[model samples]
Target: MRVFVCLFLVSVLGCSLAEGKVVSKCDLKKEFNNLPESEWPEGHTMTDNFLAKLICHVEKASEFNTSAVNQLIPKKKEEEEAEQWTLYGLFQLSDHLICSDGATPSPDRICNVTCSALVDDHIEDDISCVLNIARKVIDGGFAVERKREFWRMVKLIFQPDCNNETAGNYFAECKD
Candidate 1:
C-alpha cells in the first residue's frame, strides 16, 4: 500500500510538471488589459479587435502555451536546416529577428532580449518586443498608407486562418 501510494503521488506530480506554463484565457486577458498604451496596438482599431487579433496570433503561434517553441521554416531546402532559427512563446516571436537564443546569437537582436525570456510564463518582455516590432512595421507606413502591405505582414503571421473569415470575442468569452 505504501509503495502504491508513493508511485501514484510521483505520477501525479510528474503530470503536473509536464503540463508546463499554459495560462487560462482570463489570466491572459487580465495581462492584456493591464498593458500600457505603448505596448498595445494603436489607431482607430477597437480594443476588442486588438484583443481578438492577439488571441488569433497566440492561437496560431503557440496555442497559448507560454513555453512553446517552434522551428523556423525557410522557403528553400538549401537555406540551411530548420534548427538555425526558432520561434518562442505565445506570439511566436522569432529568435532570428527579435530575441537571442544565446547559441545562434542574433546580431541585431531587435528586441535586445534573450529568447528564453519570451518563452517563460512572464510575458512582459514578449509584449514589449511585439510592440517594438509593430511600431517598426507601422512606422514604415504599412499600417496606414499601404493597407495591403500592412495586411500582408499581419496576415503573414496568421496566414491560413487570416485567409478565412472567423469572428469571436476571444477575450470577452473569458468573462463571467
Candidate 2:
C-alpha cells in the first residue's frame, strides 16, 4: 500500500511539473518588428516591426542556441554535431546586432535603403559571428533587394547540411 501511495504521489508531482511548463507564440509579428534600430549591427539594418516579428517566429521554432553543440563547426558544415546548433548562431547575431539596446556606429551607407526604410546593417562583433558569415554570403551574389533575403540566408545556415540530423530536424521543424 505504501509503495502504491508513493507512486501515486510521484505521478501527481510529475503531472504538476508538466503543467507548470508553458510554451506560447504570442504577438509574434510585433516581437520581431519592434526591435529598435540601435540594436542593428554596424553595417546591417532592419525595421523595428519586421525584425520583431521574424524574431518571434525564429524563437518559437529555432533550436540553434543551445550549448549542446560545438562552436568550432564552420558556418557551412554539412553535418549536424550533437554539440552544435544553427539557429543559436543566427539568433546570437540577431540579438547582438539588433536586439541589444545600444548604438553601434557604422558608415553612412552601412545598410542600403529601399522605400526610405533600412534593410540590414551587416555588423560583426564577438557576441555574434553570424554577421560575418552573412556578409560573406551576401558577397557571394545574393543581392539584398528585400528584407526577405535575410530570412532565406538564416534558413540556409540553419539547414546547411541536408543529411545531418540537426539540419534535418531544422528542416522538419522549420520547413524552410
Candidate 3:
C-alpha cells in the first residue's frame, strides 16, 4: 500500500512539473513583445491580442519546430535580428514557401534562390556577401565564423522538421 501511495505521489508531482513547463499565451505574448521593433520586418507590429492567437497556432506545432520559436524571445538586443531571421524563415517555410500545390518549389530550393539573390545584391564574392549579411543580422560576430553559422541556421530552418503553425501565422500577419 505504501509503495502504491508513493508512486501516486510521484506521478502527481511529475505531472505538475510538466504542466509548469507549458508556456501560456500570456507568457508567449510577453516574450514576443519584448523583442525589439527593429528586429521585426519593416511595418510589422506585434500586439498582445495578436500574440495570444499566435501562441495558439504555435502550440499546434511540434516541440522540435517550436524550439526555434522559443529562441525568438530575446535575451539581448545584439543577437535579436539573427533570431528574428531564423524565426522569419520558419514562418516563411510553414506558411508560404513550403507548399504542396504542385507548382510550388521545395523549401531548400526557394531558400537557396533567395539567398543567391541576396548575395547577388553585393559586389563581393558569395562568402563575403554571406558574411556581411550575417554581420548585419546579428551585429558582432567574426565574419568567417558568422558566415558558416548563418548558413547552418538558414539550412536548419529550411529542414522539414521546422514547420509549425506559429510560422504560418507570422507569415500571414507580416508578409505583404
Candidate 4:
C-alpha cells in the first residue's frame, strides 16, 4: 500500500508539471489592471476585444511551429522593387518609429502601415495585424525598461532555441 501511494503521488506531480502553468486571460487582465496608468500603451485600453486578442496571441504562440520560425523573418526588397513588409518587419518598424518615442502609436497608424505591408493578400483589415503588433510590443520587452531590453519575447516564447541573447538575431541577420 505504501509503494502504491508513492507511485500515485509521483504520477500526479509529473502530470501537473508536464502541463505547465497556463497564463489565462483573466490573469493577464489582472496584471494589466495592476499596472499604473502611465504604463498603459498610448491609445490602448483594457477592453474585452483587447483581452481576446491577447489571449489568442498567447495561445497561438504556444502552438506555433518552431521549425517554420524562419518564415516570420521579413525579406528585404530591392531598391527598384516596391517595399514589402512581413509581420516581423511591421512589428520592428512600429517599435522603432512609434513606440520608441516613449508613447505607443495610435491604433490607426499601426494598423494602416502594418496591415498594408503584410505579404498575405487575403487579410484586408488591420485589426489582427494591430493586435499582433501590440502583442509584440508588450512581449518584446520594449515596455519593460525605460530604455534597453530589445529582445523579442514572441520569438523567445515560441522558438525553444531562441532565448534572450538570440531573440532579435533574426532582425540582425535580415538587415545584413
Candidate 5:
C-alpha cells in the first residue's frame, strides 16, 4: 500500500513539475540537428543552413519558450467579429491550423493536438508536428494552403536578423 500510494503521488505531481522555459540558442542548434533529413514543402530538403534558419526562426518566434502564445489581432474590421487565431509553443504555431484551444470550434486543426499540449515541456512531439507540416507538398487544398501560410508567417527572409544572409548569426556565440 505504501509503495502504491507513493507511486500515485509521483505520477500525479511529477508532470506538473515540468514547466515552459526559454531555451538557449546553441541548445536549440543542437536540438534542431537531431531532426533526421526529410523532405520539406516546395521540394526543399532539410539542409544544414536550413537548420540554422530554423533555430533563428524559433528564436524570433517564441524566444524558445514552450508556453509562448501569439494572439493574432485582426487588422480588418470584418475580422474583428471572427474568432481570433493564436500562435502556440516554441514555433509560434497557429491555433487556426496547428492547435485548437478546446473552447474554440476549429475546423482546421492540422496538427490535431491541443493548444495546451503544444505549450508543455515535452517538445519532441511539437518538433515532429512541425516537421510533418514541412513535409507536405502543395496540394492545392485548404490544408496545404494553411501549411504554406505557416511557413510564410514564420519565414525569416524579410527579417534583418536571421534572414537568408544572416542566419548564421544565431549560433555565433555558442561553441560545440
Candidate 6:
C-alpha cells in the first residue's frame, strides 16, 4: 500500500508539472480594471485581422522552411528592452485581434473568438505577454503620430529578417 501511494503521488506531481499556466483577456480585465482608458493603445482597425495575421506570420516564419527568419526576429521574452515596446505595436496587435473596424470587441468577443479556440487546441503558452503589450499600447499615453513611428521600427525589424519573399509582402504593407 505504501509503494502504491508513493507511485500515485509521483504521477500527480508529474502531471501538474506538465501542465503550464494559462492567461486570457478575461484575466487581464479582472487585473487591470482600475487602470485609465487613455493608457490603452488604439490600433484596432476593426476590419484588419491583426491577431490572426500576426499569428499566421509568426507560425509561418517559425516553420522549418522559414525558421531562419524566425531566428532573426527575437522572441519578445528574450529582449532586455522588452518593456520598452511602444504603444503603437500593442494597439496594432490588439486591434488586429479584437476590432471590427473601430468597433472594439468586448471581453466576451475575445473569450468567444480566440479563447475558445485556444482551449480547444490545448495551447499552454502565456500569449498574454503579447496581449498585454497590445493592451498597454492601446492604453498607454503615446500619441497617434508617435504610434506610426513605432510601427516603422517594427517594420524595419521584419524587412531584413525575413528570407521568404511571400512573408516579405506582409512586412511591405507596414511601409504604407
Candidate with best lDDT: 5
Give all candidates' CA lDDT scores: 0.65, 0.34, 0.37, 0.37, 0.68, 0.35
Instruction: Say which candidate scores most in TM-score.
Output: 5
lDDT string, candidate 2, 1-176, tens digits: 99999999999766533332122223322333344555445556654343334444444433322221112223543585432222222233332122231333322222232111111222123213333344545555333543343454356444333322232232234312
Clash pairs, candidate 3, are 91-167
* Candidate 1 runs further than 4 Å off: 1-20, 41-46, 77-83, 141-159, 162-168
TM-score of each: 0.66, 0.26, 0.28, 0.28, 0.69, 0.27
User: How well does candidate 5 match the true structure in TM-score terms?
Assistant: 0.69
Name the weakest run of 10 consecutive residues (lDDT summed) in model 5. Answer: 151-160
Residue 96 of candidate 1: its Cα lDDT? Answer: 60
The TM-score of candidate 6 is: 0.27
Worst 10 residues of 1 by lDDT: 141-150
lDDT of model 3 at position 147: 51
lDDT score for residue 131 of model 3? 30
Alpha carbon lDDT of residue 84, candidate 4? 24
lDDT accuracy of residue 102 in candidate 6: 35
> Tens digit of lDDT per residue, candidate 6, span 9-96?
9997666444433333333223334344543345543122343354344434332111021112223545454322211111122222
Candidate 4 lDDT, tens digit per residue, 1-176?
A: 99999999999766543433344434444554555554445666656444444434543543221111122332334655433222222122333322222343333333344322332222222234545455556556334452222233243334333323221332232221
Best-to-worst TM-score order: 5, 1, 4, 3, 6, 2
What's the CA RMSD of model 3 in angstroms? 17.8
- Cα deviation in Å at residue 37, candidate 6? 16
